[model samples]
Target: MTSYNAQEHHLTSTTCLPKPGVLIIVVEDDTDTAHLYQTILATRYHHVAVCHSGSEAVARLVSHQGPAVVVLDYHLPDMTGIEVMATCRDLEHPVACMMVSADRLNDQEAGCGEAIRLTKPLGCQTLLQWTAKLVHKVQTAVHGEGPGDHAPENLLIGQSAAMQHLRTLIPRLAQSRSPLWLHGESGTGKELAARSVHYCSPRSSGPFVAVNCAAFPEALIESMLFGHVKGAFSGATRDHKGFFEAADQGTLFLDEVGDMPLPFQAKLLRALQTGTITPVGSTRDVRVDCRVITACHRDLAQSVREGAFREDLYYRLNVLSLALPPLRERQGDALMLADHLLESLAREERIAVCPLDEEARNWIQQHDWPGNVRELENRLRRALLLCDGKAITVNNLMLNDDERLTSAPPPSQAPSGVGIHFSPGRMTLRQIEDAAIEATLEACDGCIERAARQLGVAASTLHRRRRRQAA
Candidate 1:
């Protein structure tokens, strides 16, 4: 381990591109392979360090001296690369990671979908190019320059005041060791904000473990958060290290925090307070050093008031909070983000960068993006794929002129006789309601819940109204 850092280090790329003391850690199990990675990184980036096992790599990460790019091997002597990443969740300064596997593993299988994995039998030039790019991005970010300037398509890309304010707050939150709660509409990039905080903080070298709280089954959440000893349950064949333990010295991003089961909130609160988690079927409590970052689309404060959430837990989690502005509020940002997304999509698909038509750009600007960046990406991706050539027209996005209305007006300001429009548009309120309900239901593919959401009413209300209309 000591010999790893004894080698002479460079601070610039082979092309003389200034990299200024960037540290690139290559974690590999084999001696020859580790040396190969070291040689490749030394050619392109400055200060390369090699580690043989997972534990040694983690130890190197914890002692990180500056901005870094970690090229991790999937299999190791003690723990898997994913496990090591999990352990580094709370690193103070954000580090970029590239997982390498000899066993034909992809990024998803490596449990780090955000970064793609390189297959075994590494390409020296390919590895150097990727790591150099990532290192440059990380260094640029650490120096307090606006990241949006470099990649406007990044999830955090936005020049709007709301986004700028968020950029300022990220470091503040990262500097403090406080549990953070993020509230935003779906697709507004809550997890992005969490990652921003993690990378800006001192714990940026640790794993950044993200879990969709709502994605897990109610019965399994407890075991998932607190590791379960083997035989704790019928299917518990081996001991499991839950989210809390995995996130030690890092950050555990609990997305959809509002959706966590009611019964588990007490246990969660206890762990947050005590900084200790007692695994299932274990008498011992292990101390966990990690920051808890929670996010949800719903109004958690409202949930607390409605008694759906524990007040104590709500207050605890809410000690720090950030409200992400929806895409609609970030003026002109949607178009900018769309352009960036399109460029990337074009590159990935091996096609020319598709230009947006006047109508398409207008649609993007005028329309309210209720689903935020996620929606923007999907729409653009669809347009990119469906486009014939040269330009993506409004039709490419499937945005008919009628759907261009920014938002439905308040009930009081709604147009009269929107339904059926029988006898040249003179209709009773009931008739109009019936027509609107019918149209919305059809648009939602007869999904009552979805129709109700569109209609700004409860699903049951939509159901009752639908029944009455049928009668």
Candidate 2:
């Protein structure tokens, strides 16, 4: 059994009425069936009203002044379910209307609202569950929780404008079958966004296979992507299915797609355009029905312009693009994600849930999460391992700001590797500090205290500077 906490109680209490009257207008001509619904709802709600016709139900709804949920039969003698819903729209009266019908409606035509079509001989449990969810949604909406407050499964946690905009667009994008391109910085959860789209889509039950374009060798790229027949190469032993074959009738995620060689990109474009792929050293071309979702940290358009990536292939993959905002841009979400990760780690480790103190929270929030969610998770994991009591302190979280700053080579060590060169002609103060810190760390082999002494700064100040670098 799942345990319900205070938050869960708060979630459920929105629909819990204290003998509050819920006016139910059942528009069913069948007297026996209407009575059964009336009986079920009346047992819990304070009031229940019955109407035999659509016109009568509309009139009652217009006259009613309090909360109401409507249950309309599809095969009404006068109006159809869609017609009743259209009437509600015309009246400007928002009611939680559910359609009871024996016929199936097209899933795509199902509009937003509490309009659910329950077939005849409905199971009590199923009806109750749907009703409860609908009622809760209505109550939550009425109480100013906002539509976005309801957490849809697969939505990554973040309240930043970038994330909010992405969340709003996800459902719209999921309705289409076009290829989706996810562009983001490295370790920025590109795969998570791809998975979110796949799960939110209609083909959620289908498989989700991922392949890293940069991980595979150039020699095996073709065989790995389009499969290969036995004896195709010297090492070939048996026939093997490739990513496309494995992801048939599902989603195929291509990570670091910009790294894919030009030759492979041409083949990939052909396969995508024709919905057919020929195995390596094989004459047979197999048809595949799979959604292609690709991601890359590099600027693919720039790559195309530079002749490193194919322009036609870029156009093919960029049909539906979603640029994932880096963690540094997603403010407040860092703390939210950190809390969630801490709780999750506690549960997984069977340890007492530890709260991140003010100092720790400040450090986490202020830090520039270059690695994004992945880096945050790693820091939290390390903190959890080092924590002593039910609290994660700044010290417990081994966030090495100096090491983070020095990870990237200085501008002086760029392609030229002779002297520092800034694209805009001058290096900013922060960049200078980062370069200096990198040089110092390199000289001292990551000895922060020694570096601090050499730089004539306090060790604590050096540490704070490193944290600021991370930010």
Candidate 3:
């Protein structure tokens, strides 16, 4: 009986109509309301059935042929709507259910289930829109069509073996309700991977709430995660639903989870264990049902060993883990991703897709993308904007020499560390800069690109500085 708040969910769509073949069953005890629903839906759908009792609806649903969606009233003549839905769970043909009620239901009354629940006094348009969406969702699943927007394959884009393995692993992870741990470097698409898991799961229709653990202050972390009542603190003017409650009947993604304060780890562990949260300034605990997916760039096991994170909480969140490979580790993906990003950006910007020049491709292949996919995306976006109707050159990306040099050795070949010695004389700033740049270039086997990366400057910038010093 987890009621769907229309404002909260924002799931209104009227243009996307359901297919005529899908049957819609309206289960309302009130004949006038039932007639109104049947009349409205019958105008759009070929088959619309009305059932006044829970028993009748269950029998009809269990025996219904082809794809069907039922609108079940929370108060039925024989049984509660959830009970009806739960009983039909074993039906040979799956049916989508929407429970409508005048009375608001709490998470405890019904537990978080797959059925969508909406409060009564529901608008005719809202009812129709939700019913259509549900019908489309069921039919789409049954016919094996790709889901809208957040398809796992599209979200996790790459052809490398590592990516192929992830494509296989993500769906399997989605099938379970256990806590999921996504370990990856920054910009490695941990949140995207989490999203893939959510869209691929039974809870796709519900909210997918993401929280950045590091973004919240230490003092407010508890209240942000568990909510707060009115007048809880200074500036507490109203009751606030926290991340956990906001993500009920869906997924809660905690990104950069390693940065969560150690003291709060204990409370998080308790919430995960008990499936409940006690909001700030509230004495009673509210039950919540959501799949908790957590991501961190650093090693949690190491953090636990160093006592920065809780050992027990680590185990709790790490029930099932998926490690995303950084962009640098996924060989041959950099260029492929570059093309994809360019095309996507072009479409978004309403411009023609920009091609990468030979030098740009070489630089992309050679440079170490420490920021992973995010850095690549950012650089490509910048290049796309500045390329000015030309193929994107290394200069456009600001990562290579002004006069493009031969492809440099991969970053792995660059020296791990470069040491510079300043002559004992007090040197000007320009002299110091030149000495450091020379040392880095020498250490990188005279590869300007590698030297620039090491020196934290554009290869073109490094080349210009070196030439000026020589003159």
- TM-score for all predictions? 0.56, 0.54, 0.57
Off by over 4 Å in 2: 1-155, 348-351, 401-471
| CA error at residue 64 for candidate 3, angstroms | 35
Candidate 3's displacement at residue 362, Å, is 1.9
The local lDDT score (0 to 100) that residue 290 gets in candidate 3 is: 98
User: Scored by CA lDDT, what does every candidate get?
Assistant: 0.73, 0.69, 0.77
lDDT of 3 by residue, 190-226 (tens): 9889989999999988777766676545777787779
Candidate 1 per-residue C-alpha lDDT over 273-330 given as tens digits, one digit per residue, 9 for 90 to 100: 9999998889999999999999989988899998899999998998899989988778
Clashing pairs in 2: 368-470, 368-471
- Of the candidates numbered 2 and 3, which has the greater lDDT value? 3
Question: Per-residue alpha-carbon lDDT of model 2 for 195-297, expressed as tens digits?
Answer: 6787777766676666666654576668767877878876455576776876787788888888888888889999999999999989999999889999998
The C-alpha stretches of model 3 lying farther than 4 A from their native spots are 1-146, 399-471
Which consecutive 10 residues in model 2 have the weakest lDDT in total?
1-10
User: What ranking emerges by lDDT with the best candidate at the front?
Assistant: 3, 1, 2
Error of 2 at 454 (Å): 23
